[model samples]
Target: MRRAFVQAILALFLVEAHPAFAEGPLHVDITQGVASPLLLAIPDISSGAIPEVANGEDAGVALAKVVRADLGSTGFYRFVSVDGHYAAADEVAFAPFARAGAQALVVGRVRLVGNNVLAYDCALYDVFGAHLETSQRILVAAPQWRRAAHKCADMVFAFTTGDPGHFDTRLLVVGQDGERPGLHTRLLSMDYDGANQTVLSQGQELVAMPRYAPGSRKIVFLSFVMLVPQLVLADLDSGQITALKIPPGVPSAPRFSPDGRSIIFSLARDGVADILVIDLQTGGVRQLTNTAGSNTSPGYSPDGAFVVFESDRSGDPQLYVMASDGSGQKRISFGAGAHASPMWSPRGDLIAFTLVENRRLRIGVMKPDGSKERILSDGERDEDPSWAPSGRALMFQRTAAGKALPGVWMTDLSGKLESRINIDPSASEPAWSGRRP
Candidate 1:
């Protein structure tokens, strides 16, 4: 995945902290129930030495806009416009922002540091407290300037929320080009905010379920080559695609282990389907499920010690958990209707799944022990729940009632902070990537 996109060259120019308060008073307690978004102010960053431009825009303005957009998109911060005031890096007056109902403020400046290199000097301030909380200067190549803004937003989010930010991550999704029967699907890569979209496949073959390895740009997805569905591995860095050697049977639902050294998927031959795992290093295959019915969509626990999957051995498709080596298999879902596409959250606290009841499909999450299950989406059809790197949010495909195409939507753990991601054309099967290097 190192070459998933034009690799952004990121370097730290400077990092300085204000000793006034090690931990700022302005914090969003995410552990508690859903609270209103924290009011934040992000005025235009002051411009410094003009840099060689690629997008032909003011570097300072673009940087601040990106930062504001990143933080606001998380549904954690509500950006308040401070139109008349530009929060320059050197000077910041918090009184006006406080009167504007802003709890926190971000001030920054952008300048050219080297040949084709831009530096984003950002500082996070506590508006009411009248003190600087944290500040950083990040440098990136001109073409990848947006990364600097993402990093700055990440820093602010981390310091304020006490959780790592997912702003610096990527998303892999399947893009559909036409109607069914004659439809074409391609693998696409984009920023987490749905920018920098790049087609990874030729659209010649159908692609689905593109999953990123735990910590790499390498991905394993289900693709059809000449109408034969098989699991293929693609390395973004080298543009090499290798078909996994499977023993007969058609494969589906390919997912990487938490360690990224193996892939767990399901194979169906004849009338039975079971789950299997393949060791990427040795090309060794291991069967994890040998049930009489269909068992698919196997995903690994964050620790790689266990897996959660969907099985219909009990007459209705339900979620099941088992040891990594296929021991202690037990059903976890006994809810009304069917459950499919079980995904273990990165934090290992919950498992997200697709609930099909009375011809309605919705997204829901539950604890690993099959408790505290709750629906998170009310869309007509919501499936494919992919966790953010921080495990605080999920991205899924939502096709409203009477709507023909599905759009990507995101929701926080509480389901109260749901928003649709704006993507032109239709897309599905969103897979969030780990933070970019």
Candidate 2:
């Protein structure tokens, strides 16, 4: 029963909008940053035909709330007050929402089909335009009704912002439990909004720097045994873990290739560390860097044609880019501070990294050629930037000056609208996963 619940089934189908209304030009331009959140009127979804139980309430009401919360968190849409909301029934009266100053409106219905199966239908409308933009129907297991809501929110987001939605994605973070003497560091997994958390590690050993494969259920991370770092691969669905075979060295910052066929990491042996890649299929190892100084934290460009890493070959640690096979090594960061933990954005437009200056670490981004560098966080200590699947925002670890532990915080590309992920116990090193299959 538990296994069946864990493997909850979900299906999505597009539904035709109302014939009377047509699609209109109502969109939120996110490229330039949303100056003001678009006001939306979202009423409780109606229970149509059958009243199903989900999330301790009628599936209609609960799912509507989840959808509203998901859109609100992105700092893109603001929910109209309950007093200003009208019944989101099959027939929507757009005049009321428009009079309430709502630019957009959402309406939905939930019904139960066979045993423990739910069908959620949601529609998005432009209140001012008085037209239906899109609608979708999601069928899911009762326990997985929340996924339906997330999918609905994603549909609305994509229609409004012209970008892929990231609400259905997951995040892997390093969670610390207990204090320094007997601290238990475990690899944790949760939804993008910090829900349905699960411990991926046994908490027996310290886990750090977890990264998800581009579009798979596997992850690679670093684990310490007896204070020695070891590269580990984990199958999230199977709960199986195995140590990766590599050259004799201490491995750190393991990241998957865009194709998920190989992994790139930094291997430290003797007195120096260099970036290396291991082919997961044939178990062949290749070194990408042999510079004078240490090179580490390597990430791949979206096309897998270039690699970005941090190296101190020129003195302070700065970002460098080279061909995927280790040729054409060149410095990309020429700023005043040192850069590390460089991660390429999914859209292939920017590279996010950690900039260390004046004894403080901050999260920043730069173009592929290392142009238009801009800091996105004002926290005292912000580092370990992981780009969102959409490449429009980033998640990083933030620690206040007087704090002992760091928490995960997210910021948009504009450096405005920052929020801390509401998860208990300090967490760090967040890796955002792509959309779930």
Candidate 3:
């Protein structure tokens, strides 16, 4: 019976999204398996007498590489090597690209605009249809050449997928290094692809669960100072830290509300944990869950109508959902494992969590009512699953059985592709930011 149950669970671990029948732009059916990835061609950017930027390198080539990397990382496109260069405004030869089995082609040109600014003109073409799909001209400071590339890629992604691209977002994570006796933990921020990493906090204090506010530059995290955990708010622009005054309790698993007006977290007192919310403007506290067991990791639904959290009230650490006001509390997870660290998707369609069974940790997602549970990743130790802003992907930490350091990884909703982020100092607990304004 136990073997049958395990087999049943594995059978339903993933459900692919059906391909849309009606479509204008090319949309990759991530829920279904692609027999062949879409073929794309991106030639090296063409330019004339372009001055080098900070690194004294060809800005044109650098921009092209960034664009190519961004598009290729999606797993939907397979680049076809191109030897010839074409200017951004040149007429595309559709016959060669189509004969080469390329469905899409990207061409662009980089030129110096002024003493410190550059202009990037990019164009995308449908090789088979022999027509231009879209084009854009982006102006940026020479130092921000990557941003221009990202914007260009975003244009291509949006035009192709009919969805907003997440290329311009950032990620907030906790960097951990050193041995156990002298471990160091600090707050770190970087691009979504793990570039331009900047330490936001000194290693003097231990920080965890760094969360970014929706549509804001502020991040709220739990910091341990002098062996006491406190909630701190850090401003990315001003580099200021402020301690939030909460009720007399130890706070953990802090997250910003959907509107960013309040914060919901788990507070422990007298060996009992409960969910609590505090108004950011008025600093008023309200207890949401008053249960005997430990209830933590509260995540709000997209509309802020419901919250899902983890608790041991049912004898094991399972998932539970309740009303925003702490009403209608009920268990949602009922599989053969313990579920923890539940986070509601930004689209409010699914809840992502860490599942532990047979002493192996995995990342899983399920419906709000916890009916269609499906494990997305398998690793020796994978925990703290956070959703992408578009709700199509998740970022988590994975540590091998014998490895002491944990690296950050991302997996899409389809569970077809998993890639480790290239960051230093061993990162964990990644919190993906929404699109920046």
Candidate 4:
């Protein structure tokens, strides 16, 4: 079984390196020169008898706010508010929007379907070309009305940018509070915009490096049990926790495989750490790296054929890649500073990482082969980059001068726009989940 597995992995390496086997839509290269933000007009969705939900709020106006916020946060659009502008979709005047320099216009309306259901009709238009781009009618339970707005914004984002939208995603983060001596951290989940925050774990146990399982509601993290680090699997829905049967070692940086059947992490045995993988179903273990120096922060390529990790085998911590089964290990980063926390983009085009130079940390991205490295952020401390599901942006932890608290902030892949996620009780270790079904 081991021999055949190695052979199959070798075959995959050959195929994956070639151009023909590559799949997925081509992503826009945002690293190029800064472009002007697209002018977009978002009129409030007409509230035609749209009854309030349990929250006693105007569902139509709330939905429009969500849509506007989602698009505005992307940093690729300049919003034209609809305060005194058109209210209903039919009242829209394309000529006025075009004259106001709006290239695209989004108009929608919300109405009550029944006592417990709501319907939203959204439409996108090309103002300059005077034509309708797309339209859809979405229905949802009154309590779930936020999702309908997200769906509408996603449609507009996809129609304009030619990429999948990330508005309908959730983020897993470690929520920390209290003073330094008594700091407490807990696992928390919330919408990408910091809404609907849910605490997934109590603060009794120390946890770090929370990662979401691909296409699953489970998360893999490192939890301290009896002062020993153990890899734990957490189900989001049921709040169940199961410890993986890894060898007795200090586990950290656990990330799920693309198939969600296995996890790759670093385990420190004795005084050295190495990368390893464990199959969840069979409790089978496979060692990926056996180097003398510490090898940690293993991240899988989107296709699951290769794994990138940070290792100090070269005397300085740098990025390295090996086959999924721990073959053909080679160093890929040779920059001036040490690099760590390497995260492969979901679109499979670039790798984001943290670079430390002269005692300062910055977030950057480079090609898979470690070329064309470009630092995208300038912060006193910026680390732990987690890619948005669409690979268009990144969320990382930022700590400013005189502010010991670390807060979560996001920036476009180009670093042209940056915004802080407004969540009380400063947070860190943000892991953006894949688009939820």
TM-score of each: 0.92, 0.91, 0.89, 0.89
- Residues 279-308, model 3: lDDT tens digits: 999999999988889999999999999999
Q: Per-residue CA lDDT of candidate 2, range 122-142, in tens?
A: 888888778778887777777
After superposition, the stretches of candidate 1 with alpha carbons farther than 4 Å from their true spots are 1-15, 18-23, 48-54, 87-90
Supply candidate 3's per-residue lDDT for 34. Answer: 49
The lDDT, on a scale of 0 to 1, for candidate 3 is: 0.80
Please write out the lDDT profile of model 4 over residues 37-143, one tens digit for every residue.
77888876546445445265666667888999898888778886434634554567787777777877888777766756676777777787776667777776666
Tens digits of per-residue lDDT, candidate 1, 1-437, equal 23555454556557788532245567887666547778999888657425554266667778888898788767788888765745344466787898899999888687777887887787888888787789887887777777788889988888887777888888888886666322877788888888778788876778888999975478889888898998999988777889999889999999999888999999999989999999999999999899899989999999999999999898989999999999999999987789999899888889999999988999999999999889999988899999988888899998878877777888888887788776668888899998776
Off by over 4 Å in 4: 1-34, 48-57, 81-85, 88-90
Clashing pairs in 3: 17-31
| Candidate with best TM-score | 1
Worst 10 residues of 4 by lDDT: 5-14
Alpha-carbon lDDT, every model: 0.83, 0.82, 0.80, 0.79
| Candidate ordering by lDDT (highest first) | 1, 2, 3, 4
